[model samples]
Target chain A: MEQPILSIQNATKIFGGGFLSSSKPIVALDRFSLDVYESQSKIITIAGESGSGKTTLANMILGFTPCTEGKITFNGIDLNQMNGEQRSFYRQEVQAIFQDPYEVYNPFFRVAHIFDMITRHFKLARSKKEAQELIEEALNLVGMRGGEILEKYPHQLSGGQRQRVMVARAYMLRPKLIVADEPVSAVDASLRAMILDIMLRLRDTRHISFLYITHDLSTAYQISDLMYVLFQGTTVERGNTAKIIEDPRHPYVQELIDSIPVPNPKIKWNMNIKLPSEEVMRMKNTVGCRFYPRCPKRMDACTKAFPPMVKVSEEHEVACYLYQ
Target chain B: MAANEKILEVLDLHVQYFTPRGAVKAANAVNLYVKAGEIVGLVGESGCGKTTVAMAILQMVQPPGRIVKGEIRINGHNIVNLSEAELRKVRWRELALIPQGAMNSLNPVLRIREQMGDAIQAHEAISARDLKARVLSLLNDVGLPERVYNMYPHELSGGMKQRVCIAMAVALNPAIIIADEPTSALDVVVQRVVAQTLLDVKKRLGVSMIMIGHDMGLQAQMVDRVAVMYAGNMVEVGPVESIFAQPLHPYTQLLIESIPSIRERKPLKVTEGLTHDLRNPPTGCCFQFRCPRVEPRCLQAQPAMIEAGPEHLVSCIHYQAR
Candidate 1:
């Protein structure tokens, strides 16, 4: 029952504003927050569909974007108010691995640019020999040989290899927290397992915390210790990975779980599923319930006001009218 | 089954791309059969020749990639040696393809209905009224509303566009539908829906299928039989249950172990190295570098597909005998 290693208190982020903006400023993160304790497993899986604010939440945690409202504390260090020098150090403590590894590096340059970029800012290595050693060490951790990986252009490497190089670059800094956004979705299907395995090792071998953002729940199940299901920027359900998956409470959570392709032919097509009519855009963007329109189990109060995050159990939390 | 009744039979199929280092063998001597009214899955990792096999079957493998030496028999006719005019007759009517990137395969500038109509009319002598009826029914069959026909490809969502592509592929209800990563670009939920629709279509029409994908879970649900490809070779294959329950190949085990399953959270076993570059591969087993139980036998030569169980074959010299 010790305090979590990291915590976020009611974080909210909104993008775009103006007279023409009749649509609600897509609430990228609706008073969103989560906790990560170092003792337990070190992966926090953030899941959502296209419009879900999964990426926005991850960016705010990495301090890439300022939260429009709310507090983000990493080891109780407020991310919003950090000064330039402090921010640079924070950058070292927190690193990122983007979804597309090919895009992470330039096609023209050798993969070593990643190491060079860090050396200019931080004293990653004491000397030329140390620097080479450091780079090779990081590459080795990502399952790459330095002789081939460091010299090759991004175009020359496979999607999985490129991602490994990206992870290696991140490892070079020895960050306490890593924000990986859909890291393996672009890679070939066979190569996906390899990348996912590397990430699993990251948490176990190095004690690195990961804020994994992905829409694929199948792989998400494998990597996450704790999962927070996000729908349209609001937390639909948050609980232990196995518990929530086995018996999801919220209707939206159930639908997301049911939507996964099980390895059975008998469990076939689901019935007339009703997704929200795009007209939900016209629904009063109020504080009551963002999911009511799409929610299968709708209530009178659902459309009237926004739902509150109620604790269903010691570790389980859900934002729904039923709880209220 | 009649020997000639096979919708598609690929024999000694080899597809290679000429790279700077040398000819990269994208596909090896893969022999497969797609009979009537059943589905076969071609599963493997990125470099495993899954996509290459699909493209070569369609004769879409352009320069750098030559069919080189093989016999692709679609509906008992050899497509490999066919002329342009003869190949044209075989393109859409006899063999249909739902290519790797479903949405991207579509012509963005054109309307959904137009492509369907053109495909149908190009081969069969159907009237305009019949074409309209056929396109609408195709849309309905794939779970899309009939109204999707009027919309542009951009207007429809990713899932919707994929369904439209599937509709077009089976517009003629060709004997075989080769869906190459049809749902790869879509999300899990969308993928399930799309996959379900394909199953429904296959059952209703009694058409044979060659479903190609990377995800074993998805492949398990859709295909009755599986052919696991690795570095252009059909490394392992059998009934879906047997393949999952008793995998014979080390690479197959590595792939299965690597996947994070929802039902179980076992520690993932990562293959040590990267996929071999086909252009300059290690002159032995494609999986030897990363195999869990590498040995001297594995380095001698690539293992041929040998039957290890009932309809189960493995192409690995380092197979651990039970």
Candidate 2:
């Protein structure tokens, strides 16, 4: 039997804009929903530009912030109603990988201390010998040795090594899901592949779901099994990674896909690239669509009310007036 | 010197950082030249010495990190031996730098107009009225609105701030502009605009540019020529078209293959192992430890860069004619 490991239903995160506040409410995320099944481990990438609320969604998944409306549940347990014991267990089941590897670790402490804390906090080992064994196993999975990295400080290890250590720590916990927010964005080009490769291995071997968040479409297409294209807190497109990458539908998605500089020098970009307009659409007052102002194929009704998600295929759905 | 030839040239450049642990050879015997109105890309991963070469070109290499050997010539003048006072005259007027972080580059306490005034006044004796006009004209070239001139850095968006930096770089009408990861901090949409802005500046001013970036995709789009660096050495140099289509060096081949393209969906063929540590770099070839097609000679001696195709130079022992 298959059950959803994580389910987000109509999650909305609104910052400010109430009776007490004079500023307009900024809708960081609006009615976003997603699901991950435990029976099938996959990488679900949330792709968006800056201010597109991808980080907000990742923070929601990490349980750092509660959605103002709707709910997020892990293994049938709602986040808004979890007890202290349940919350602790939820923390153990879900781990996070951050963007900056340098900031993740404390410069004063030995790098091995992070893994030790993970094992002790999660109660993964009963004795010091068992903890050492677990640490070695996790390190081996990420192509690192406990002997080389154990006694070293954070500064001693390279950027790639520090990021791999984070992966190793996540592996030690045996988490059901890992939320990696721009995991390789700060790392160098040569090292990005190694970190991404580790994530793929974790998915294949450990059967763990990864909620990946990034602005880089190339990397998103490389690792994601499924992808969601967000535009200003709204899910404009969602489908299998290949289908979406091959043929993007929404105007925003199309622009984003076209904007990526191709590695082939033969194909040069013209000066015809579109810049995002500065026209602000007040969410509270306006309705047709959140992307109405910047959307290339926007209709008159697109400015009247929010557009609904329309089914394009069995595995694809897009929110736009074009399909309708 | 020939008319409009070689705006900037760096020959046998070597820069090293002397730390308490050891000497980190950041740039080793690098040779590069930028022709007038051409954009040459210096592509490499972090710590591969792309930025070091850019800094050394402008004599911006700080203490503990000095250029031990090199001839950096700007219009045939050896800038490497120029004094501080002599260098100042050629600094912004002949050579300019668009630094990495756009937001951090601006003074938070100062207004945009005041910052621009400082840069313009340092070079030429311009009045306040003339400075404003000059700054506005530069900003207009980058497609920035006049309102941004009076605003603080905090008031502008990341993309707008980057435009300000671009405007400031070309304020003195320098012949060469070295942009280090100009669009790395901006979003894809903003990056495209900033990139287009760079192209516009290059076209309008006819100033040669050395764009330092790790993204090969952006490099392919913007640069006329490409140079690939590994550990501190220039592993490959060639026309952008030739290098992208048929990379001769193993390191360049691996780098081009690693980039994830939107046009195709193939598993990234990643080369194993991390980059070499500068303090204890390997003899012969820096990429020998991680190269897939490394030969015995690769371990013993560093291969000299040999011409593989028209305008294409590669450094590898096992590269054969195709």
Candidate 3:
């Protein structure tokens, strides 16, 4: 079998268990694993609500934070053990697009400054003319023109335009994977489709895989080929995006899918549905299923110990006592 | 008092922000109304004047951004020209507002009881004991627990904080509630829960509401009627089902088509072209620059709202000719 491009095995990230601190260590992510192959580019969605550790997973993968347990390897090289040259290569191979496009930019600099910094740091271009050509090419790939946006300051461009420029900046690196954290959450609906379409185009044409992290399931459903539904940092369900959305196996996944208000008025949500209080939902359950407090079909065994991932179908897996 | 009676109405409303540059027309001749028990959704892209219209309806347009010309009639009373003292009498008692990002709207330093108490006492001279009863009942109406009364805003979750805002909005039992994206900040499950809380509260109180948001899916599920805005102009208004089923205006159509659906996957429909500058809007249609079915006549003069179907209004040259 061919090696995967990126592989995460039993990754665990716990924060704030310092020597002097009295607060309990918060398990932001626990026992999460995923594999992305280089042969086929895909948009893999890591979806969960805020504080559900989706961002923590993204941070771990981007090397912004270190995992307390397990290992993450890129092209057979462990991220934690990478040397100086390998670290720079990994940086060039993996680029990121953040949630707030406005905050990512220096308000004082022109939009072109972002691309220029990337070119100088990565040594992608030798001369000014070569750098200009590269920037234009990257912009054109994202369906934007360099002439209109390059000279303008970050404040001058709209949210959608700024996001597209970020995409173009990531594309200029010619990275294998783009970690986009809620790229379109701040953009409007009309322009949101444009950004998501760019992700799809990049996957199909350029073979640039994407780790699309978002809380928005609708857009994730529209673009992601694969999905991992996280519940308070634990992988409740991992499978094909369409199949999981259509027939969500885990109880948390079921609730999450039911919560999305359908666009058609004919299909209204059942108004009688009630959710448990946030306090109960956020209670630390070290040994039991994290969703046991809120799960509708929870059993006594669910509280005894955490359930392992059980194969639901050929390509789908769910971690639930009910499935077991 | 009767259902379907117009409880709140905005007639030819114009809100302008006078910056160093020419006046930025925020809401231009925008017309909207809310019936006694209906939820009218005001939706548009950012900077398209959804929030401006909400602020104008509340008579809270800030300095440098004045209500240039219009009448905001609440319960058949034109409060547009009312003095601050006179407006205060009508503000919360008749027209309550659940402002945008309502999670952060709550005072972190105050308990939920104190904050809600402030809202109630500001409008009514209620006894302390009675205020406690009213606040608890208001919390119950929004499906919040009684324990939340003693908890501070920071202790509660985003969804709970939003429900607290909803409870406060109904504290005065106002004739109308303007919820500006009440569930925009929460997660999907939590957003649904908050949305359901809003619906339950509305059903119980029978208060007319104007829901301002950009989530088309949410608007489809919650609102009785939908109003589409473009560059500060109300382009289309119709029944919720009709607006989703057969959106008339080019911009409205584009807005609906752009919604990403969960049931199926298809090529996204992208709307190109930038919104015209608000400081100097085009003489003709506000959406003419981005309208897919643009005609030469559309650039000649601004199209007036014409009835395209039963109670459906559209401002477009194509609809006008029809």
Candidate topping DockQ:
3
**Residue A106 local lDDT, model 3:** 97
RMSD of 2: 1.8
Q: Which stretches of candidate 2 lie over 4 Å from their true place?
A: A276-286, B1-4, B319-322
Tell me chain A's TM-score in each of the predictions: 0.92, 0.97, 0.97
Give the TM-score of each candidate: 0.90, 0.97, 0.98
lDDT, residue A87, model 1: 80
Better structure of 1 and 2 per DockQ = 2
Q: What lDDT tens digits, residue by residue, belong to model 2 across residues A1-324?
A: 666878999999999989999998888888899999988999999999888899999888888999999999988999979999999998988999999999988899998889878787778899999999999999999988999999999999988889999988987888999999999998877788888888998999999989899999888888889999988888999989888888888888988888899888877776686555343533332356777766677778787778899988878899988998
Of the true contacts between chains A and B, what fraction does model 3 have?
0.89
Q: What is the lDDT of candidate 2?
A: 0.88
* Over 4 Å off, model 3: none
For each candidate in the order shown, give its overall lDDT on alpha carbons. Answer: 0.80, 0.88, 0.90
Alpha carbon deviation, residue A18, candidate 1 (Å): 1.7
Model 1: CAPRI class: acceptable
The prediction achieving the highest TM-score against the true structure is: 3
How far out, in Å, is residue B198 in model 1?
A: 0.8
Q: DockQ (Cα-based) per candidate?
A: 0.41, 0.75, 0.83
Candidate 2 TM-score for chain A: 0.97
- The superposed Cα distance between candidate 1 and the true structure at residue B28, in angstroms, equals 1.5
